[model samples]
Target: MKKGTSPALEVIVATHKMYVMPDDSLYQPLLVGSDFFLNQQKGVTLPKNLILDNTGAHISSKNHNYSELTGLYWLWQNTVKKDTNPDSFYGLVHYRRFLSAKNKKTPLTKTELQNLINLKYEIILPKKRNYYIENLYSHYAHTLHIGPLARTREIIKEKYPNFLPEFDRLKTRRSAHMFNIFIFKKPLFEEYCEFLFGILFALESSLTKEELTRYDGFHARFFGRISELLLDVFLYTKFPDLDKRSDVLELQVLELEPVNWIEKISNFLLAKFFGKKYKKSC
Candidate 1:
């Protein structure tokens, strides 16, 4: 827990782009509810989700299709449609938005900018892989140019008045993006095993171009410290929920299993060092 000896577990930053099932119908409301509460209590609760990290930026729901163009909007607008297919509308609208962004020369609105910055998961465009890479690298470099944490938080809160967990997660995951939903997304812990699985997902192997260079010089240093790094993360996970005994036990089990192997190696090394010390003392 020393200041300088903190674990330097580097996250290789990359985009998590993937084609999602147009499950926008199911997820949209949940997203709304979460955002609403997050914004309503914005001044009181720390807006941890507002921080943009590897998962991407938090998209404002204002310009988002679900609220503006879908049956959900109609429902809110008091124009109920009997055959208004939620799924169909979401897919069509999403496509329209995509094409609009691609073909149009218009400047991106605040909402569009937020989605591009945060909501769009990083995925490699197989055909235009180089372009994707270049664009993402540029984004990573310039992400913080326009705003700092407080300003960024305010901007997103203005968008998703109902839910802001994704934004909250960006803050938590800025330090570590390898973690999937557990770090930033809502965690689903069924039992100890599931909890352990959540932690594992938080571990990622993203390395930016610049980070790769540092690895070359410190291969030995990095390898030597990985065990300690993992252990430290396991320990650090307890905070913000230290009283959760079940979670604490799961973490201990997770750490101890690996610690057994680490302990044996350390014991051998200590024996050798002590023998050498005694010989020198003698």
Candidate 2:
């Protein structure tokens, strides 16, 4: 892959606010992830590719609910530049949650990204995340309305039967790979996005807004939250002993520290104790 011709690894930094970051040697395509209507309204400026995320379900009006995955949808549904770079690996990292260097805090450089690929790593992920004293299901139930968590199970059983056992198995685990963040080879990226969105879209249609809204503002981005848990399920399905076989997660996962710790911690605690019942009005 010649650098002048096309990038080998292209990551879409999903951001929705009015901000700017100039493109550099590393391939960062700024994706404005929101519905077409809101995209026109946000007035954000990116160096390249500020995509209107409405191309899929026109769900940008509900962007508060889908969160960053909405931007990912735009990359999946639109993004012609990927066609020009057929072998380019794709990744979605937030403006806040970049894949950091092992010893330093900066976005992984072109050389680091290429080395991972050269090593035959299948994916790049943040490090193993743990929520002590809570099985995956119990923690989710305490935080979000567990109904949708349950519904996801039924959807898999009814629609994607093959995945049901792993789904069931994953529900019992205490830790997970989270954030809707990942890097994949073009082919695996395609497989992952297709499998992920297919479940989210179908599971959501079975739900009403009443059923979906758990945290008035935050949980509304329910699909993204739910998908975070499923990533572990997806991985375990592929590599049943993944945790044991590779604490490094296939040498495929590149670990990083997430940004915005204050808000992130607050949300986790609030969700844990309150679920949808955290009411200031009370």
Candidate 3:
């Protein structure tokens, strides 16, 4: 591709120069430098003009910004177990699947779970406002062996002889109760939940009266910083042209919060009007 001729294609090509085809074809690899590309067939027909204009609907600069911000936040929050709560984390996934799939006896109830789901999505689905507390442990584990947590847990024991076997043993069970035992040795689990609590208040959502009463300084700092980051991303994306010079920076700050809100409302309405459209052909 000619330099700077196609700004959209050029941007991707520049970032992924090493990942481009050796042929003279104009194609650039998607998910460049990642294992996802390494697994692909080499002789596949790589098309020129493979990338679309960033100005188009799905390919717009705004959507690109939104997806990137959401992804970064997703990475940040995925590290914290409580943030990845099926109730907190995957509520949208379950809600969509259960309502639109063969399963009818879904554990989630709109009446009972809506408040909880709303609170979580508001806080977590934005540019992930919280850091994963377990990243250090995950980093330690991954450094030993590249596999799932259970396998990595075993590797940790063999590699770090001084590491406690009890901690490894607890990690294997994958229980919340198991986590509580070794959690203090790793920082930020309590801090993670405390951040959630502050968000709950900001959203003006109902919480357990006890959650409302608890007070902690570390919790305040953790949440305050995250909330500010989330709000900055939200404001920047929604009004990027507010400062034209650095629209790219503002774009980078975008998140999927607006789209998430639309989807949540749409799903709620779909569930209500369509009588939960499950068993339909995909």
Candidate 2, residue 248: how far the Cα is off, in Å: 6.9
Cα lDDT over the full model 1: 0.24
Per-candidate TM equals 0.17, 0.78, 0.18
What are the lDDT figures for the candidates, one per model? 0.24, 0.66, 0.27
Off by over 4 Å in 1: 1-83, 92-144, 148-150, 155-162, 174-282
Arranged by lDDT, best first: 2, 3, 1
List model 3 lDDT by residue over 138-218, tens digit each: 322322212222432343345433333433433232211110001010122234333333342333233244442353322
Return the clash pairs for model 2, or none: 65-220, 65-221
Q: How many residue pairs clash in each candidate?
A: 23, 2, 1
Count residue pairs with overlapping backbones in model 3: 1
Q: How close is candidate 3 to the true structure, as a TM-score?
A: 0.18
lDDT of 2 by residue, 1-282 (tens): 123445456777776664454254554544444554454676644444454555544456556767788777766655523455546677787665667557655677778777776766656777767778678887777766677778889998998888888888755777777767777766667777788889988998998766766457655666777888888777778767766653233212332333456765676677677564322211
Which regions of candidate 3 deviate over 4 angstroms?
A: 1-104, 114-167, 170-282
Residue 269 alpha-carbon offset, candidate 1, angstroms:
39
